[model samples]
Target chain A: MSRTANGRGGHGRTGGTARRGTGAPEAGETAAELGEFGVIDRLTGERFQPEQTLLGPGDDAAVVAAPDGRVVATVDTLVQGVHFRLDWSAPEQVGRKAVAANLADIGAMGAVPTALLLSLACPGDTSTEVLDGLAAGVWDAAADAGIGVVGGDTVSADTLVVSITALGDLEGRAAVTRSGARPGDVVAVCGQLGWSAAGMAVLRRGFRSPVAMVAAHRTPRPPWRAGPVAARAGATSMIDTSDGLLADLGHVAAASRVHVDLSSRLVPVADKLRDVASALGGDALGWALTGGEDHALVATFPSEDVVPADWVVCGEVRAGTGVTVDADRWGGSGDPGYLHWR
Target chain B: MSRTANGRGGHGRTGGTARRGTGAPEAGETAAELGEFGVIDRLTGERFQPEQTLLGPGDDAAVVAAPDGRVVATVDTLVQGVHFRLDWSAPEQVGRKAVAANLADIGAMGAVPTALLLSLACPGDTSTEVLDGLAAGVWDAAADAGIGVVGGDTVSADTLVVSITALGDLEGRAAVTRSGARPGDVVAVCGQLGWSAAGMAVLRRGFRSPVAMVAAHRTPRPPWRAGPVAARAGATSMIDTSDGLLADLGHVAAASRVHVDLSSRLVPVADKLRDVASALGGDALGWALTGGEDHALVATFPSEDVVPADWVVCGEVRAGTGVTVDADRWGGSGDPGYLHWR
Candidate 1:
C-alpha cells in the first residue's frame, strides 16, 4: 500500500479521486500558499472519523477505547520516488495505498482494523488540491475498511512521505502469528498477486490500455475483512503479501520452521494477470510468484476446507526449509519480488 | 518537536557520517548496498527492543496489551534541514528528540507512555552506522520513559524523515482535553521553555558552547512525569509546549473559550537562557514566551495550591478568549512559534 498516491488520469482504480466524492483542489493553490493549519483543516475535515473514536483530531493526543484491552499496531512509510512516482499516481491513490497497506498488515495479524494515524510530509510547493485529493482517498479507503482516521501529523519536507500507522481490535480472538505454521499446514492466499507489478510494467512501458492492471497498480484493494474471517476459521501463520508471495511465505517458512512448496500452475492469480503479461511479454506466473505491493493475505491453515471464498489454497507446508515451486528452489535476488533499495 | 532535530553546527549539515556511536559502516556499505532486509536487520537488532512488548518486531503487526482498556495515540514528523541539521547533532540525539516529543504529547494527555512506532525514511546511500545510532537513541529514549519500541517501517527517501507514533495507557483516569478548561483555573507549566529555542539560535549563528543550551537544542528532555501529576491533581486541560508556550496556550484558550492572562515576570525560564540570549544579543523573554520544542506540559489546574512543585503558575484563565501577556494582548504573527508553510 505504500507509495500508491496520485490519482492521475481517470482510470477507475478503486482508490481513484473520482470515487472520493469531493471537489477537485484548485490548481493554483499550493500547500505552502494555504499554510499548515489550512492544509490540515481541509485534509482532516469531518468525514474521516467514525463514531467509535473516543476522541478524534484537534488534541494533544487522541484516545481510542480498546475494549478488548489489547491493541495490534503496524506502520508503513511511502516515499515519493521510491514508493510511488507522482507522475504515475494521483494523490488519492497514494492515500488509499498507504491506508490499505497498513490495514493489510493488521489483517495479517487476524484483527479488525479500527483506527489509523497518518504522518504526512510533503514539499511546501505541493498543491493543496493534491493534498485534498490524498486526504479524500484516505477517507474513502478507511470507510471501505470499516475504520476511521483518528490522529496524525503533517510536516514540510523536500519530498512527499506518507507514513501510516494502523491499530486494530482482535475482538478477543487469539492473534495468528507467523510462528504458528506447522509441517502439515496448507498454504493459501486471499486477494491479488501480480496485477500491481504487471500494471506498473504496463505504465512504465507507456502502454495505457489494459486498464484493470493499471488501476490495480494505482490502488490496490486489500481484502480488509479477510483477517478476522481467517482468524475465526483457524489460520495458523499469516502475513500480508507486501513483499511478494514467495518472499513473504519465505518469512513464514523461516519463522514457523517449516518449508512451503508451491505449485506454480495451481495458483489462480496468474490467470488474472495473463493478459497484462502477454502485452508486456512478461511471465504472469513469475510476476504472481515474486511481485510485491499487492497487500494480499498469505496464510497457512491447519485445514484448507474451512477457508472462506476470499482465500484459495496454493501450496502446503513440509518439514524442510526455504520455498520451492514444484520442488525447485525459487530464483535468486533481483527476481521481481520488489526490492526497496534497488 | 517537529523542527528540533539538529544540534546544528556551522558545519555543512547534509547528514555527516561522523556522529555515529560505534562501528563504522564499511566503505560503500550504503543502505542500498545492504539491501532492505539487511538494513532492516542491522537497524532492528535485539538490544534495542524493550521487554514490555507482548509481540516485538518481525510480525506483520505487533500486539501490545492495554491494561487500562484505553489507548492514547499521537504522531509527529521531523524532516532533515527543517527539523535538524545533521552536522550539529549526533544520530542518537535525533532519535532521542523524536521519541521525547511524542512522549511529551502522551504525558500532556495525562497518560503513561507505553509503545513507540518509528517510521524512518532516509536516502539509500545513508550509512548503516547512522541508522544504528538513530535506533540506539530511540531505544535509550524509550527506556528513559519506561516504554518499549514495538514496531516501525523504513523506506528510502531523498531526505531523512523520522515520523514517530506513540501509544499510551490512561490508567483509568479521564483524559485531560483542551475543551475542559474553565475560568478561574490556574495556568502553569513544567520544564524548560526558551532553552531549546535559544540553543537553535546559537547553532544558527555558528556560535557553539554555553554547552547546556547547545545540548538542549540538540535533545530536549521533557518533564514527562509532570503530565500524569497534573492530571491526578484535577487539571482541566493540558497541552505539550511544542508550539511554544504562548502559541500552545493560545490553542488551549481557543479550545476552552477562556482568556489566559500571563504574568510575564513570573515565568522563570528566561533566567536560564539569559546568558545565551545575551551572547546572541537576542531577547530571552521572547524566546521563553514563544520558543518551541522544550516539550514542557502546560496545564490548567482547578487550584493553584494543588499544582505540583515541578510546575509554577505563569497565568490565569478568565472568562474571555485569546491570550494576554502582562494584561496586554500577545504579539502578532511572525513570532517564534514555528509556523509551518509560511
Candidate 2:
C-alpha cells in the first residue's frame, strides 16, 4: 500500500502554454512535433547523477546503488486536473510537488532518498515549454534531495499524469514504521501544519493575496530530513502529515493500536495562518488539526527527553483508540480529512 | 530515453465489469464506494511477498533487499486505449502486460528482477472486478518472475493509467549496456519476433480464429531469462525488441557507433505466421524484421559459436553506421516500427 494523499483542490491552468521562460520548450513546439525520442531526450539528456547512480538513463534500465543491502521504495501519482492546475501552479511547481510527495514518504521511513524514476502520460499536443518546466522542477527537487532522475517513461494519454517512483537507502539502520508507537510515547511534529490547506483556502476564494500562503499550496517544502533525525533520536513510530495532521495521526494510531491525545493549546497555530483565517472568517485550529498536504513529519518518542529540540511536543500516546483533542473527540469545521472518491 | 514500445493497436472492452467468477468483485461494487483505503487494502492485503521484500506494504514505503548492493530500476506506463483495451485483453492480461514490460527491460540489462512498485490511476466509477483482475495479473507475473509488488499508489483520474517500476539485481556482474557492440559481434535473437504484431493484425482484421496469435498479443511470454544467459555467454550488447527488431538494433548501432547487417534468409519466420500473412496479404518476413512488442531478447555476441544454443544468429555488427538488411537499407511496408505521438 503506497501512501496516497487524496482530495487535493486543484485550480488554474488549462494547458501547458509557456509563460515565463527559463529553459522552457521553445514556443509552438508540441510533444507530437518533437516526437517521443525527441521529447525523451529533452527530458533526460543532460543531467549529472550521483555516485549512487551506477548506470543512469540511456540504457534499458538504470542501475542504482543500494549500498545498505536494502532499498526503500514508494510511488506517487499527480493528475493534472485533480492534483494541480497549470494556471495556478507552474509546470515546474507541479513537478516539484510530485517528487516531494515520494521523497517525503522515503523520509518517513527514516531512509535517505537515492534515485527517482518518472512515468509521464500526457496529451500529444502538450507544449514543450511545459515539458521543460516540468523536467526542470523534477531535477531541481531531486537535486535538493541529493538524488537524480535515473530512468523514466513517456507516453501519450488523454490527460496529463505524472507518476514518480522514489528509491531510498536505510544506511544499516532499522526502518521506523507507523506500527511501532507505544502507549507511553510522546507525539511531536516538525515543519508547517495547515499552511497548504490555508493556502488552498486562499486560492479557492479567488484571492491570491498573502503570496506565501499561495506559494505553500503550490510547492510544499517538507522537513524530510527531520524524519531521519527523529528516527535516530529513538522515535517509536513516524509518519508524514500528508492527509492532514489528525487524519495522518489517525493512521499511525490505528497501525500502532494506541490512542493519541492532543492538547489544542499545545498545537502550534502560526500567526500568519491565524491572520489569514481571521480575514477569511475561518478557524485556524481546525485547519491545523484537519487540513492536509503540508508534508510535515509527525512522530512518537518514548519520552520528552529523547524528542528532538526542533520537534514540537503537542500530544501523547495513551491507552485508548483513535485521536482526541482536549480529551474529547474533535468536532471541527472540517471532517477528519478529505477522502478520495467520496 | 526509457525505450518506449509504440503503436500497439488496441481493441475491445468499455469498462471493468465482472465477467469472470474467479475472485471477481462483488456484484456492482465500485472503487468510489469502497473509498481509497478500501481499494488499497484489496489491492495489496492478500499477497505473499518474496524474500527480497524485507518489509511489505502498509508502511509509508516498502523495504526490498538488494543483496548485490546494486538495483536495476526501470519504469513503464500503460495507458487505456493506447496499450490495451479492456475488451480485447482482460484486466488480468493488462496487469501482466504492464509488469512484463518492465521485467523485460530488467532482463535486457542482464539482471534478475527483484521487486515492483505499481501506480494505478482510474475513474472512481471503475469496477472492483476490473481492479481484482488487474491485481491478480500483476501478482501472477511477479510470482513468475520470483518477486512481488512491494509498494504502490492509486489515485483518481479520468483515464486509467498503470505505471509500474521494476527493481532488479545484477548479482555482482557488470551490466551489459547498449553501447558495447563491437565491429565483429554476431547479432542473435532468443525469443519470438513479430508474433505480437501478427496477433494485432489478426485482431485488427476482426479475425480471432488463431487463438494462439491473439493470446500472444494479450499476454507476451518474454524470454527474460535469456538475457542473463546471453550475458554469461559474453554478449557484447543487448536490447528488448519492444520497438521492433530493426529499430531496436538501430539504437544499438547508434549507441555503439557500429553497423548491423541482417541476412534476410537467416531471420526466422514461423509457418503459422506465414499462413496468417498469406491470409491477410501481409509480409511475414517484413513483420519479423520490423514488428514490435514481442519482448524478444536481441543481442550481439563476440561470435556465432559464442551465441547460446537457443539463440538464432541472424546478423553481424560492422565498423560503420545504422542497420541494413541483406546489405541494403530496409524497403519494407511499415516504417522502422511505430513512433508514439506521430
Q: Name the candidate that leads on TM-score.
A: 2
Which regions of candidate 2 deviate over 4 angstroms? Answer: A1-21, A24-28, B1-28
- The sequence of per-residue lDDT tens digits that candidate 1 reaches over residues A1-342 is 000111011111122123323765543487788767666656654454565678766787778878788898888888888788778989899889888888888888899988887778888888876788788888889888777677777788899888888898899998887778899888999988878888888999987758788888888888868988999999997888787888788888887788999987777655558877776688888888887888889888998787778788989999988889888986633254555567
Candidate 1 lDDT by residue in tens digits, B18-63? 3233555544468888776665555543434444467766788778
Which candidate tops lDDT? 2
Tens digits of per-residue lDDT for model 2, B1-342: 000000000101112322232554544488798777666756666467777888777778888889999888888889898888988899998999888778888888899999898888889998888888888898889989988777788788898889888999888888887888999999999888888888899999988857877877888878999988988999988888888888889888887889999998999888888988899999998989888888888999999988998899999999999999999999987547666677
Q: Assess every candidate by TM-score.
A: 0.92, 0.93
Task: Determine which window of 10 residues in candidate 1 chain B has minimal summed lDDT.
Answer: B1-10
Give me the TM-scores of chain B across the candidates: 0.90, 0.92
In terms of docking quality, how is candidate 1 classified?
acceptable
TM-score of candidate 1 against the unseen true structure: 0.92
